[model samples]
Structure formats: C-alpha cells, structure tokens
Target: MEKNKTIKRAFIASLPVLAGYMVLGIGFGIMMRDKGFGVLWTAAMSLSIFSGTLQYVGVGLLAAPATMIQTAITSLIVNARYMFYSISMVKKYKGTGKYKPFLIFGLTDETYTILSGETPKDANENKYRFLVTTFNHIYWIIGGITGNLLGQIIPFSTRGIDFSMTAIFIASFTEEWIKKNNRKGAIIGVVTTLVCLLLFGEKWFLIPSMLIMTLLLSIKPKREAAK
Candidate 1:
C-alpha cells in the first residue's frame, strides 16, 4: 500500500518533466534527423547521454572531426552546472545503496530542483527519490523515441523549440521560489546569469555564470556567519 502511494506521488511529480521532455526531446530528434541521423541514433543518444543541450551540441560535434579532447572540453563547459549540483546531492544520496548510481546518472535540472526543494518526510525517502528518478528517465526515453518517430513524417521549423528547455528551467526555479526557503540563492543565480549574459553573450555565458555562482555560494557561509 505504501509503495503504491509512493508510485502515485512520483507519477504526479514526473508529469511536468514528461511534458517538457516530450517537446524538447522531439526538437532534438528533429534536429538530429536534419543532420541525417535517424530514430535508432536518437534512441541511443537519449538512452546513453540523456543530456538535452549537450546532446544537441554533440550532434554537430559528431558530424565534424572533433577529437576526444575537444569533445571533453565542450561537454565540461556545457555541463558545468552539475558540478555545483553534485556537491549538495552527494550528502543526500549518501546512503542510497544501489540506487545511488542511477540516481546520480539521472539527476537532470528538473529532478535536481524537485529533490532540492524537498526531502522525503513521511514516506521512505530513498524509495521516493528512486521512484522519481526512474519515472523521469522513462519519460525522457519515451519522449525521445516519440519525437524520433514523429520527426520522420513531419516537416516543421524548429524555431523556438529550444525555448522549451528554458521554460522548464524557469518553471523549476519558480517552484523553488514559491515553495522553498533560500530565495536569496535563487536571486543570486538569476543576477549572476543575467550579468554573465550581458558581458559574455549567449554562447559564452553559461560557464562563467555557473563559475561565479559557485564561487559566491562557497564564500557565502563564513561571511554571512560573521554578520
């Protein structure tokens, strides 16, 4: 009975992810097809990499003659945010046993926000997290394959499709703002991101923003405590 309840809660939590992933995953699929890749390739990437923007960038890389070092640098630059995310999640996922590996692998932006906003209270905490992680992964895979299939038959413009990922992040931030404490942290992230964009432009802003935010937060404790 309790397990059933946890499943229901997890399903509810994953619905938004389902919506976001379906749209963005479809966009990725369409983009991949434009590069002459097909459904199986999309499935493989989605299953193995499971990164949204990185996968998109990686498609271009794959088409080119980029070396291993080049690929590594690009992935590191693109996924710098996860460095901060891993710091906090390390404690929470400490006792997760076998689920730890999968949980860490599947920790996307949306999942991180949801998990960060709240820990399990009444239910089995690890189990709840496992369900949430597993469900979201399944949703992503479904969306990727669905898009791959649809992109084959549909001719469409991918303009503004990338916005779906941004929208999902915004929605997650909003949820954190409304329900979670530490609004200052969220404000700092926004301010740093905007400043980075203005200074660096869109193509070069992400890494700078993440770096500054992590640095600011790292120094926050002693300084704030001194106050």
Candidate 2:
C-alpha cells in the first residue's frame, strides 16, 4: 500500500515532465526521421543516450559524416552543464545504492528538476526519486518511438522542430522562478547568455554562456566574518 502510494505521488509530480518530454522527444524523433533514420535508431538513442538536447544535437551529428573525435568533443561541450547538476545531486543521491546508477543515467533536465524538489512525508526518498526518473524516462522513450512511427507515415517539414527543447527549458525556468522567488540566478543566466550571444554569435555562444553562468552562480557572497 505504501509502495503504491509512493508511485502515485511520483507520477503526479512527474506529469509536467511527461508533457514536456513528449513534445521534445517527438520533435527529436521527427528530426531524426527527416534525416533518413528510422524508428529503431530513435528508440535506441532515446533508451540509451537519453539526453534530449544532446540527442537533438546528435541528430545533426549522425546526419553528417563526422569522425569519432568530433562527435566526442561536440557531445562533451553540449552536455557540460550536467556536471553542475551532478555536483549538486551528489549528497542527495548518496546511499541510494541500486537506484543511484539509473538516477545518474536518467538525470535529464526534467528529471533533475523533479528530483531536486521535496519528497513526500513518510515516503522512501530514494524510491520516490527513482520512480520519478523511471516515469520520465519512459515518457521520453514512448514519445520518441511514437514520433518516429508517425514520421514514417507522415511527411512534413522538420524545420523549427528543434525549438521544442528551448521551449521546454523556458517553461522549467519559469516554474523555478515562481517557486523559488529568487530572481538573481535567472537574471544572471539571462544577462550572461545575451552577452555571450551578442559577443560570440549564436553558433558559439552556448558554451561561454553556460560557463559564465556557472561561474557567477557558484560565487558565494562574503559577509563580515562574525566580527
């Protein structure tokens, strides 16, 4: 009974992620399909790699005749922000035992947001986190497969589909902004990103923006040391 209740709560908490991942994964699937890949490829990537942004970026990589080193460098640069997420999660996920591996593997932007939030009273925290991760992962896989199947049947322009990722992040950002009532982080991120975009141009702005944001957010304000 307790287990079932935990599952229920986790699912409810994960509903937002479900909505977001479905659209983003479908967008990814459609892009992959338009690039001449098939449903199997989509399913495999969604199941294994499981990073929506990376996978979307990967669609372009897979479409091109890039070498291994290029793919590695591109992937590292694109997913570098996760380093910060993992660092934050280190203590929370400690002692999670069997759940830790999947927790780490499934820790996408959506999953991270859900996990970082509060756990329910009298519920197993690790278990709740695991279930949320599992549910979001399944949603992503299902969405990708569904979109790939649809892509096989329907023909349309994949142009602008990639923007779904950006849209989802914006939604998450808004949610965090309202929930935390802290505007400093958001302001820093926005100002840093715009500055980088203007200085570096769209093609090269992401890495610098992320690096700058991370650096700024990590700096702790110093107060007079206890007199």
Candidate 3:
C-alpha cells in the first residue's frame, strides 16, 4: 500500500518534468536524427548522457572527429554545476543503500527539484526519491524514442530548430518563477546570466554565469535560514 502510494505521489510530482523532458528530449532526438543518427543513438544518449544541454551540444561533438580529451574537458565544463547540486543532496541521499546508484545517475535538474522540494511524507524518502527519478528517466527515454521515430517519418526544417533548447530554458525558468521561494533564485540566475553575457560576451558567459549562480544559490539558502 505504501509503495503504491509513493509511486502515485512520485508520478504526480513528475508531471511537470514529464512535460519539459518530453519537449526537450524530442528536440534532442530531432537534432540527432537530422544528423543521420537513428533511434538507437537517440535512446542511448537520453538514457546514458541524460544532460539536456550537453546532449544538445553533443550532437555537434558526436558528428565531428573530436578526441577523447576534448570531449572530457567539454563535458566537465558544461556540467560542472552538478557539483553544487550534489552538495545539497548529500544528506538526503546518505544511506540510501540499494537505490543510491540509480538515484545519483538519474539526478537531472527537474528530478532534483522534485526530490528536493516535493518529497513525500507518507513514504520512505529514499523509496520516493527513487520512484521520482525513475518516472522522469522513463519519460526522457520514451520522448527521445518517439521523436526519433517521428523524425524518420517526417523531415523537420533546419532553421530555428536549435532554438528549442532556448525554449526549454525559458519554460523552466518561468515555472520556477511562479513559485514564491524560487523567485529569488530565478532572478539571480537571469541577472547573473545577463551580467556575465555583457562582461564575457556570448562565447564565455555560460560557464561564468553558471558558476556565479551556483555560488549564490548555495549561499542564499543558508542566508535565508539565518534570518
């Protein structure tokens, strides 16, 4: 009974992620398909890589004859913010035992938001966390496969297709903004991103902004708690 309820709660919490991942994963799939990769490649990337922004960036990398060192460096730089996110989750994930591996592997931005904010009270925290991660992961896999299948059947216009990634960011930011507590974080992110863009230019803004935002976000909660 508890497990069933936990699953239901996890599904509900994942509804928002379901929508986001479906669109973003499809965008990724369409891009990969247009690059001549098939559903297998799409599914493998979605399941294994699982980083939306990196996977989108990866389309270009996978097509080019890049060396392992370059790929490793690029991945490290792009997904470096995960280090900050993981720090907050240390206590929540401790002693998770059997579920720890998948929970760690499946910790996407959306999954983190749900597990951190919408965690259930009626069930074991670790179990609920596992279910939420599974739901979001499954959504991404299915969305990627569906998009690849559709891509095989229908051709997509090349123009403006890459903007889907931007669209995903906007949607996620908007969703976060609608919540009262998340408002400050959203503002911090936008301001940091824009300021970095102006200071560093488009090419270098992303890493600086992410680093600054992670610092602010990590510190902000502690400041608020002290007040």
Candidate 4:
C-alpha cells in the first residue's frame, strides 16, 4: 500500500513534465525524420543523447557526419553545465544504491527542477523521487519513438519546431523568476544573456552567456547576505 501510494504521487507530480516532453520530443522526432534517419536511428539517438537541444543539433551533425573527435568536443561544449548540476546533487542523492544510475541518466533540467523542489514529508522520498525521474524519462522515450513513427506518414512543417525549445527555456526562466523574491538575480541573468548574445551571436553564444550569468548571479547572494 505504501509503495503504491508513492507511485501514485510520483505519477501525478510528473504529469505536467510528461506533457511537455511529448510535445518537444515529437518536434525532435519530426526533425530527425526529415533529416532521413529511420526508427532505429531515432531510438538510438534518444536513448544515447537524451539531451533534447543537443539531440536536435545532432540531427545536423548526423547529416554532416562529424568525426569522433568533433562529436566529442561538440557534446562536451553543449553539456558541460550538467557537471555543475550534478555537483549540487551530490549530497541530496548520496547513497542512492541502484537508483544512482537512473538519477544520473534522468537528470535533465525539468527532472532536476522537479526533484530539487520536492519537499517530501513521506518516508519514501527517495523512492518517490526515483519514480518521478523514471516516469519522465519514459515519457521522453515514448514521445521520441511516436514522433519518429508518425513522421513517416504525416506531412507537417517542422520549420517552427525548433522554437519550441526556446519557448521551454523562457517558460522555465519565467517560473524561476516568479518564485524568487529577489529580482536582482533575474535582472542580472537577462542582462548578461543579452550582452553575451550580442557579442557572440546565436551561433556560439550559449556557453559564454551561461558562464557570465552564473558569475554575476553568484555574487548577488553573497552581497545580499553581507547586507
């Protein structure tokens, strides 16, 4: 009974994320299909390169056929920040036993947000968290596979699907902004991103923008604390 309840709660908590993943995953699938990858390729990509934005970019990489060294460098550049996110969770997820692999595998932006914000009062918090993470991952897999299959027959434009990722980022930023009492961090984030984008342009701006944003926001809290 206790385990069943935990599963129920996890399913409910993950419902919203599941919806988002389905929509975005479908977009990615359509893009991959248009690029000439079949179902096997799509499944492999989704399973191995689970990063949505990176996976989308990877479609182009597949078409262009980068060397192993280039693929490694590109993946590292795009996903370097995941190292930082993992650092923050070291203590929260310590001693997770078999759950460790899944935790690492499912540590996407949405999963992290949901797990980090979950203040579980129940005794099975770890189990519940794991369930939530696994559920979201399954949603992504399903969505990706469905989209790839559908893309074979459907005649739809994938032109604007790329924008869906940007929309997700905006929505996430807005939610974080609204929840925080301090507006200074939010303002700094916006300013830094804009400056970096102007300097670097859309082609090569993300890493630098994130680094500047992190540095700027890192000091704001200390300043607030010192006051």
**How do the residues 134-210 of candidate 3 rate in per-residue lDDT, one tens digit apiece?**
98898898888888778445454445544544554566566656766568777888899999999999767887898
Model 1 per-residue lDDT tens digits across residues 1-227: 77777777777777767767877787777777778788899889888887887988988887785899999999988887787788888888899998898889888887887776565455567888888888877777777777777765656665665565677678778877787656878988999999999999999998899889878877759876586
Let me know the TM-score candidate 1 reaches against the reference structure. Answer: 0.87
lDDT of 2 by residue, 90-196 (tens): 98999899989999998898788768766888567888999999999999999898887785554666566556556657777788788874578789989999999
Q: Per-candidate TM vs. native?
A: 0.87, 0.81, 0.78, 0.79
Q: Which candidate has the top score in lDDT?
A: 2
Off by over 4 Å in 1: 152-168, 223-227
Q: Candidate 2 overall Cα lDDT vs. reference?
A: 0.84
Which prediction has more favorable TM-score, 2 or 4? 2
Query: Residue pairs in steric clash, candidate 3?
Result: none
The weakest ten consecutive residues by lDDT in model 4 span: 157-166
Which window of ten consecutive residues has the lowest lDDT sum in model 1? Answer: 153-162
Let me know the TM-score candidate 3 reaches against the reference structure.
0.78
Leading candidate by TM-score = 1
What lDDT, from 0 to 1, does candidate 4 have? 0.78
Off by over 4 Å in 2: 152-183, 221-227
Model 4 pairs whose backbones collide: none
Ranking by lDDT: 2, 1, 3, 4
State the lDDT at 219 in candidate 2.
79
Instruction: Output the lDDT of residue 121, model 3.
Output: 79
